[model samples]
Target: MTKSQKWVSFLILSMTCGVIYQVAYIRFVFLGPTARALDVSSQDYANIISVFGIVAMVMYFFGGWFADRLSPKFLVVTALAVTGIADLYLGTVPGYWGILAAHVVMAVAGMGLYWSALVKAIGMLGDSSEQGRLFGFLEGVRGVTSTVVGFVGTAVVAASVAEAAGVLWLIRLYGILCFVYAALVWLFVKGDDRRLAGLGSSTVTLRQLWRAARNRYTWLIGGTVMLMYCFYTTLGYFSPLLEHRYGMAAALVGVIGVVRTYVFQFVAGPAGGVVVDKVTRSTPRFLRWMFAGCALIALSFLVLPRDSAFKWVALALMFALCLLVFASRGVYWAQVGEAGIHPDERGGVIGLASGIAYLPDAFLPTLSAWWIGDPSATPAVPEQGGGYTALFLFLLAVALLGLGLTTLTDRTRRRELAARAAPAGAEAAPLAA
Candidate 1:
C-alpha cells in the first residue's frame, strides 16, 4: 500500500476498532442483571461498576505488553471478533449469571487489544505536529461511532423475542458485524509495524515497563485518570439518572444520551482539542494549567439546584460537563505521545498507560450508583435521589479528585524535569528506576 493509503487505512481501522469495543462505555449490562438478581440498590450498582475498574487495571497491564508485542491490526481485529462473540453470548445466554459472564468475556477481549495499541496506531498516522489533530479526530469518531454501535446493539437486542433465545438473533447479527469489521481491518489496515518488531526487542523489557510504571509522573497521571472518572462517571449513567429523577421514559432518556453524544462529541469535542493544543503550545508550564482546569470542570456541576428548574438547567450542566471531558480526553493521552519513545515502545507504553489510566472504569460505575442508587434494580422510578442534584454532586467530587492528582503530578514532574535539566544531571536521574 502507498503511504497515503496506509494512513487512511490506519485511521479507518483504528476508529472502527474503537467504536466496536466501546460497548463498555455504552452501558453496564451486568450491573442491571446483577441488580435484579440480588435485589440491590443503585449504591450496590456503583460497587459493581467499581469491580470493572479492578478488572480493567489488570487488562490494561497485559494489554500494554500485548500491544507492544503484537501487530496493531492483528490484535485489534482479534479483539473485535472476541468481543462480538461475547455480544452474541449476551444475546443468547440464559440467566443473570449468563449476562455477567458475557461482560467478563468482552472485558477480557478488550484487554487483549485496545488502548495503547490503538493510540500508537493513530500516532504513527502522523508526525509530532499532527498527533493532536489525528487523535482529536479519532475521539470525535469514537463518540459518534460508538453511539451508533450502542444504539444498534441495544436495538437488535431489544428487537428480538425478548427471551434469551430470541435475543440470539441480535447477538448473531452483531457477531457477524464485529467479525466482518475485524476481517476488513485485517485485510486493509497497514498501521504501524513497529509494534510487530518491538516484541523481540530488548529495550521494552519487563524491566523498562517496571521502571516506567514506577515513575512519579506515571503514577500521578494514572491515578488522575482513575479519579477523573468520578466526575465523568456521571455521564455514563446520566440517562438513568434522568429516568429516576424526571419520570422520563428510559427510551426518552436514551435519546437524550444520543443527543449528548452528537452535540458535544461532534460539535464541542473538537473545539476542546484545539483549545488544548493552543494552551499547551502557549503555556510554559502546560500540565499545571491542565491540572487547574480540572477544578473548573468540578465547579461546573454546581449550576443546578434539586427542586428548581429541571430539564434545561440539568441538561445544560451535563452538556458542559461533556464538553470539559471531551476537551481534556486527548490531552490526557498526550503525555504518552510526548514521552518520545522508540516507535516500538509506543504500543507497550501506551498499553501500560491505558491499563493504569482506566483503573476507574472497573469501579467508577459502582461508585456512581452508590450516589445514585443500585445499578441492578428495576428501572429507577422518578423523584429519587438518583436524580440531577445527587448525580452532579457525585460528578463534582470526581472532578475534584482528578484536579488534585493533576496538581500533584504536575508539581512533581516539574521539579524532576528541572533537576534533570540541571548542570549536575546525575542528581536528576530517574527516581522511579
Candidate 2:
C-alpha cells in the first residue's frame, strides 16, 4: 500500500478501537441517568468496573505476544466483532452477574485481543520521527468521535420517556456502530506481507522477553503511564464531585463530563503531540513538563476553599486539570519510540508496560467510591467537599512521582543513545596501515 493510504487506514483503525472499547462503560463515567437507572450503588458499580481491569491485566501479556505473531488487521477486526456482540448482550440489561460477565467478555475482546495490536499498528504507520504526530492525531480524532457519540447518546437518553429505556437504546446504538466499524476495518485495513513473513519464520523467545523486562527504561515508561492513569481514573469522580459539592443538576453534570472527555481531549491531544514534537522535541522532557503541570493543578484543588461561592473557580480549575491530563495521555505512548525499543519487541514492551501501568484501573474506582461516598446521598450534606479534597491530595502525590520518573527516564535514555552512537562512530574510523 501507498504511504498515504496506510496513514489513513491507521487513523481509522486507531479511532475505531478507541471508541468501541469504551462504549460499554461510557455511562458509568458520564451519564448519571444510566447509573441511576441501573440502581446500583457506587460500591457495587466500582466492583463491576474493577472486573474489567482484573481480567485485562492478565490478558495484556498474552495479547502482546499475540500481536507479535498474529496479523494486526485480523486481530483488530475480531476484537471489534466480539465486543459488538457483547454490547448487544449488555443492552438486554441483565442482572448484576450478567452485566459483570459481559464486562469480562469485553475485557477479552477489547484489551486482550485489540489494545496491543492497535498500538503496534499505529506505531507501524510512521517511522520514529512521526510517532508523536501519528499518536496525537489518532487520539485527537478518537476524542472527537467519542464526543459525538456521547452527545448523541445523551440526546437519546434525554428524549426518552424512561431513563432505563434510553440507556438500553444507547447500548444498542453502540453495538450497531461497532459492527459497522468492524466491517470498515476488514475492508480497508490491508495485511502487512513483510511483517507476516517475519512472523512466520521467527517465534518470540524467552530471551527476547527477558531482555524487554530487564530494560530499566521499559519499567520507567510503564511507571509513568501508571501514575498518569491514577489521575485519569480519578477524573471519573468529577461528575459526582460537582453534583454533590456544588449542587449541579445531573443532566448538566453529564454535559460537563462529556465536555471534559470529548472537547478537552480533542483540543489537548493534538496540541500535546505538537508540543512534544516541536517545542520539547524530546518525549521525556515533554512528560516532565506535563507531569509538573498536573502536580500544580492538583495542588490547586487541595488549597482552594470548598465554598459554594467559589463554584466557578472550582470549575475553571477542573477544566484546566482536564486539559493537562488529556494532553499527557496523548504523548505518553510516544515515549516508546524515544526509549529505543526495537520494532520486533514493541508489542511485548507495550503490553508489559500497559498491563502494569493500568493496574490502578482495578482499584481506583473502589477507592473513589470510598472517598466520595454514595451518589444516592443527599447533596445538602456539608462534608462532601472533604472527600474530594482527600482525593485531590492523592492525585497530587501521584503527579509528583510521575514528574520524578520522567526526569529519571530522560537521563537514562540520553545515556543509552550516546552509548549506541559511540560504537558506530568508532567503527566508521579508518584503520592506519
Candidate 3:
C-alpha cells in the first residue's frame, strides 16, 4: 500500500477498534448508574467484570493464533457483527444472567478475534522504525473516538427521564455503531490479507507457537505489559473514589469519569510515541523511566486526603496518573517489534504477551471489589479501612516491578544489537553495567 493508503487504513482501523468496547464495559464508564439501572450490587457488578476477564483471558491466546491463520478483514468484521448483536441484546435490560451471557459473547468476539487481529494489522502497517508512532497514533485516535462517544452517552443520560432508560439508549447507540464500524472496516481496511498471509504459513503449529511463547523477550515485555495493565485496570475505580470521598452527584461523577478515563489519552499517546521513537530511540528505555515516574505518583495517592476541599487536587493527580497509564499503554505493544521476534512469530508472540498482559482483567476487578469492601461506604469509615488506599498501594508495587522488568528488557535489547553488529566468529564486547 502507498503511504497515503496505509494512513487512511490506519485511521479507519483505529476508529473501528475504538468503538467496539463501548457497551461491553458500560459499568466502568458509568459505574454507579449502571449498577442501579441493572439492580446489581457493587460486588455482583464486579463479578460481571471478572467473568468478562476470564473469557477474554482465554480468548487472547487463541486470538493470536487465529490472527496468524486468518485475514484481519475477516476477524474484525465478524467481531463487530457479533458484538453489535450481543450489545443490542444487553440493551434490552436483560436480567443478571442474560447480561452475563452478553458479556461472554462480547468477550469471545472481541478478545478472541478483533484484538489480536488489530494488533497484528497495526504491526504490519509500519516497519520496525515506525512501531512506536503507529501504535501511539492508534491509541490517540482510539481515545478521541471513545471520548466523543462518552460525551454523547453522558448527554443522553442528562436528557432522559431515568438513568436506566438513558443507559439503555446508550447501549442501543453503541450497538448500531458497531455495524457502522463493520462497514467502515470492510470498505477501507483493504489489501492486508496478502501481506500478513505471506508473513506466516496458514498451518501454524502449536509447537511453533509454544516456542514463541518461550522466548525471553516475550516474557519480559509481557511482564511489563501485565504490570502496566494492572495500573490501567485499577484506574476505573477512581470514579467511585471521587464520588464516595466528596459526595459528588452522579452526573458530575460521570463527567469526571469520562475525563479521567479518556480525555488525556489523545495527548498522552502521541507524546509517548514521539519520545520513544525519536527521543530515547528505545521503547523499553522510555518505559523504564516512565514506570519510575508512575511509581512516585502512585505513592502520592496513598497519602492523599479524602476531604472535599482536596477533591480537585485528587482529580488533578488522577488525571496525571491517567496520562501516564495511557501513554504506557499506547506504546507497550511496540516492544513486540523492538524485541526482534521473527516476522512469522509476531502474532503468536503478541497473543502470548497479551494473554499475560491482560491476565489482570480476570482477577483484578474481583480483588478490587474485595479490597474496597463496599463502594457505598464512606471513605473515612475506619471499619472500611479506606479501600482506595489499599488499591493504590498495590498499584505502587506494580509500578516498581514494571520499572525493574523494563530495565531488564532494555538490557536485553542492547545485548541483541551488540551481538548483531559483531563480526562473524568475534566475541561481542561487554561494557560496565
What local distance difference test score does each model get?
Answer: 0.57, 0.76, 0.81
TM-score of each candidate?
Answer: 0.73, 0.83, 0.86
Better of 2 and 3 by lDDT: 3
Worst 10 residues of 1 by lDDT: 28-37
The whole-model C-alpha lDDT of candidate 2 against the native structure comes to: 0.76
By TM-score, the candidates rank as: 3, 2, 1
Per model, how many backbone clashes are there?
A: 21, 0, 0
For lDDT, the strongest prediction is: 3
Q: Highest TM-score among the candidates is held by which one?
A: 3
Residue 408 displacement (Å), model 1: 3.8
| Residues 1-433, model 1: lDDT tens digits | 4777866676676567545554444443223432433344556435544555566567665665676677666777778888887766655544555555656667667754765566666666666687667766776676666666656655654454542332355446666777877878777777555534532332245756776665555566566655554545556676654555434555455556656654456665556556656755421134345435545644554554433247556666666666666555545656654443455555456556656677667665654555555432444344355544565566556565665666555556556566768876545544321
User: Residues 1-433, candidate 3, lDDT per residue (tens digit)?
Assistant: 8888899889988998678998877766687677667677777778898899999888766776787777877899999999999989987878889888999999999988898788778777877688768876787789889899888899898789997788888889899999998988888776655556544433345766698778997799889999988878877787877888756677887887778777867878778888897888888888887888789888887887777888878888888888888888778888988888897787567767777888898889888877786676765555243477778888889989998898888888888778887767667767425
**What TM-score does prediction 2 earn?**
0.83
Q: Give the per-residue lDDT digits (tens) of candidate 2, residues 240-348.
A: 7677666666667767878887888778877888899889898778888878988998888788875677777878888988888888887898899878788878655
